[model samples]
Target: MKNDSGAVAAVKARANIAEIVGRYVTLRPVGSRLVGPCPFHQETKGSFNVHPDKGFFHCFGCQASGDVIDFFCRINGLEFREGLERLAAEVGVDLGRARSDPRAAAKKRERDACLAMHELADRYFRHLLGRDEGRVAREYLERRGVSAEMIERFSLGVSPEGWQGLQTVLRGRGFDDDSAIIAGLLTQGKNGRTWDRFRGRLMFPIRDGGGRVIAFGGRVMGEGDPKYLNSAETPIYTKGQHLYGLYEARPVMAKTRRALLSEGYLDVITLHQFGYGEACGVLGTAMTHEQAKRLSGFAPRVDLVFDGDAPGRKAALRAAQMLLTLGGACRVVPLPDGEDVDSLLHAQGRDGFEACLERAEDGLNFCLRMVRESYAPREIVAWAGEFLGGLADEGLRALFIPRVASGLGLAEAELRRLLSRPAKRPAPGPRPGETAAPRQPAWELAPRDAQILSFVVRRPDYAAHLAGAGAGELLGNADARLFFARLAGLVSDEAEARLTEPETAFWAKAQMEPPVSDEDAAAFFEELCVFLHEARESDRRRSVMDAIRLAQQRGDSEEALRLLGELQALSGRGDE
Candidate 1:
């Protein structure tokens, strides 16, 4: 969906294309026009070109080009309001009353409600944890060797053991149990009562890259069927959509170009304590293709580490499949039989942990080995073999096939047979109108438009030229002449003799490239007559001085000195 009308309207308001592109991209003068790479698509070539005289964009690589607002929206992934905000920032124009978008606005309001609920709950939990009654949860974590700094870094909180403790607090804050249930912070009981969803536990808040608290994960100190509890999904938070600790890990991963994916929140923290702060984990689900793609945007590679158990093996295999599908590098670390990522780090420290990483298998290879170990029958193994083979690209298959054969101790010919098999369905074709024509200047120029060209190229001198020449004959174009006269009149008489300011204070809304019409030409001529009068006055003063100087040199003292004093006053060179 494109806002074609908005683009057309903004384009019409602009006199030149450079002004349009300047909203999104910086432009530098090249020959007669400004040039910069198009922001419409990801291309480095200055194929997206603009002509200052014509307000439009032409992209050579992918023809999806438009005007200023379109450029802002497409580049920044913003809506009309957001684009207006950016334009306001650029030229300091305040966007007026916003038009109706009730549906989007409602969704934003709901998300804001969810956000506020999360904040209130987080603060309450933190307050509970810091109190004397939270001693049990605090000591339990301390006994487990979790440092105070680590607890604070994770925003660890405690939930009271009483069923109605948190529910009472929320209810007093004007939210009934139903409201808390809707916010995913509480669960209603079958006996017409409500209680805290998390009780007698330490809480860990899960957030996105923007650090907005989307959900919470709580761990119980005592034995239970499910040792950990989490907030249910709400409008702004989705469990499968967000990975735990990703918010904190993102910046580090972006800087390092590597991320470590672990099994639990504690594993993530332990790795950080052991000096791998770019470590993160999935919350109660197998890693999905969506999570893999998001992680890849920050880090070039992800170490898909899981527990050394059957369930962990399955999770690692799923992570590998997603990574292979998305085409990024993955390394798999197999911990000791009884150890998870957390224990391994705590027991071995950074040196021992890194040693394990160094020996880790490539994720795809680890998945292949796991598949070999879990063979159901020859039928199932063959299908697994085929699926694994299909994951490789042509180039990767060439490099990986020999390695896979050697790792499995199978013949290369046999592996080749599985790889050669093709799928029934094919990928989609290129998007329609995806190819952009090579960009050319959108506006045309004359070979003899040097005077118009000089206005932009030589602003100081040429502006002064316009100032000296008065109006109509000063600049070539009627529009330029009219604007220059108005701009020149802005300069005071004191500024005239020194060529300092063209006095264009009144030229604020004055379109430099005004519309050339009969009226404009007439106005130019009117300004020209007044400018010529001043030019003649200047000429007469110079002539009188020359005659006086010649006469003085020949002993005509009266005429020489009289002419010199008159010249100073007429030129505004003397103090008035």
Candidate 2:
């Protein structure tokens, strides 16, 4: 199936590849391509090459090669569809109208409407914050050491006390109750009347990586039952999919390749104000795999700053486990018994916070300490098994298994065997915590097959030459055969969607190699085809010999002679 061709093509056509990539990497023109140090990884030689004419980039250092959309997605931690939508908006392309499918178009329209409603609501909240009604919230922010600059930077606002305050504003702006409610800006009561969802609270606009307001998180200015109120899941926002200040933190994160993962909006803002610009907060929820993955794009190292209380330590431990399992380096910044990032920063300033960071411990070491403290010696094995079982990558699991085994005084093999069994429900009672692991390729191909597949993936134009070459038949690995079969008639771009995750990774990596000339590709293709043909014949001869031996073992003279003659004919044809 084709992608949203009209929308994708329009966005790509309007996008200047060099200009877009230059925002992240400093580039200088080199022949037809622009060259720069790769933003995806550290390199001093400027191996990242961007071809303006082709509208694609390739990093010789990291093997990252993709079009403008791919670059935007990779750099910003966005999915393909989300990246496309953001780019489409940038290019002034109405994706809904560009789509041919009526149903899909309608859905896109609803999504767009929700986003517009959110923007409108954000403005309304900001307007309320500057007015007389916002006096109480403004005073509260000032008391908490929040500056006017930060208020503007984070788009901090106040929702008026009146239930209909925001409802009226939205209605006046031409937003219906249904649309406002769907955008998580308003709520419907039991009496069937709609009202502002966030009232008498300080508003923090939560944005996506593109800096568009997608949702809001509200904090009570004074005493309240539920201290914090966040926007419910809507068309444009999911609770665990975004970090509060990521949009603002991205620039610093890109430079440092590190992030400060905090647990509150004020914490993130405070960190930034204190020169820790590479800081963001979870949206009032536990850290998630999606959020971890998003952070991994900008920062390879994450410093988790949580409260010093028991619950905060527990949270830090959990977050660190997730970061480690996701192949991210993490450190836990420990605070005093009653301190948090915001409180500590306000009390002691940047110097004090830096001291805490200096005292941060490695993630795995913290995990081991927590587990040892929380669990008894008898329970260590069970805990180790559960943690190791949660890890999907056997190699990563193996690396950790030794350390865990050493900590628990158990054999590494014993822990491996425990993980090998089917996962069981956690034993009854309170547990220390849970952790997750990263993923790796599940299968590998023979060297010869891999070389052939890599060539075809990069030079898809030559796939036609393999039409009658029996290359697929000679592939011993099932993954290689399947990839070859599906990729035979597809273009390089189209092949990505059809491939498995591992296959797509292989395909992308192969594209990083130096482009082969047509003559070189032809010669390589010819040599591989000959090898496959010879291998195929050798297999046929081996099978015939096996059959002849089987017949002879059965003491059937006539059958053995017949098989021998067939084998001789097969060998004769191969020799010819």
How well is each residue in 35-128 modelled by candidate 1, as lDDT tens digits? 7654433333466566555444556554544445445544433444445444554554543444245665565556656767778888888888
Off by over 4 Å in 1: 1-99, 377-576
The runs of at least 3 residues in candidate 2 whose Cα sits more than 4 Å from the true structure, single-residue gaps closed, are 1-10, 13-65, 74-79, 91-96, 389-399, 409-413, 416-503, 513-576
Candidate 1 overall lDDT versus native? 0.63
Model 2 alpha-carbon miss at residue 385, Å: 2.8
lDDT computed for candidate 2: 0.78
Best by TM-score: 2
TM-score of 1: 0.58
Error of 2 at 317 (Å): 0.8
TM-scores for every candidate against the unseen true structure: 0.58, 0.75
Report every candidate's CA lDDT.
0.63, 0.78
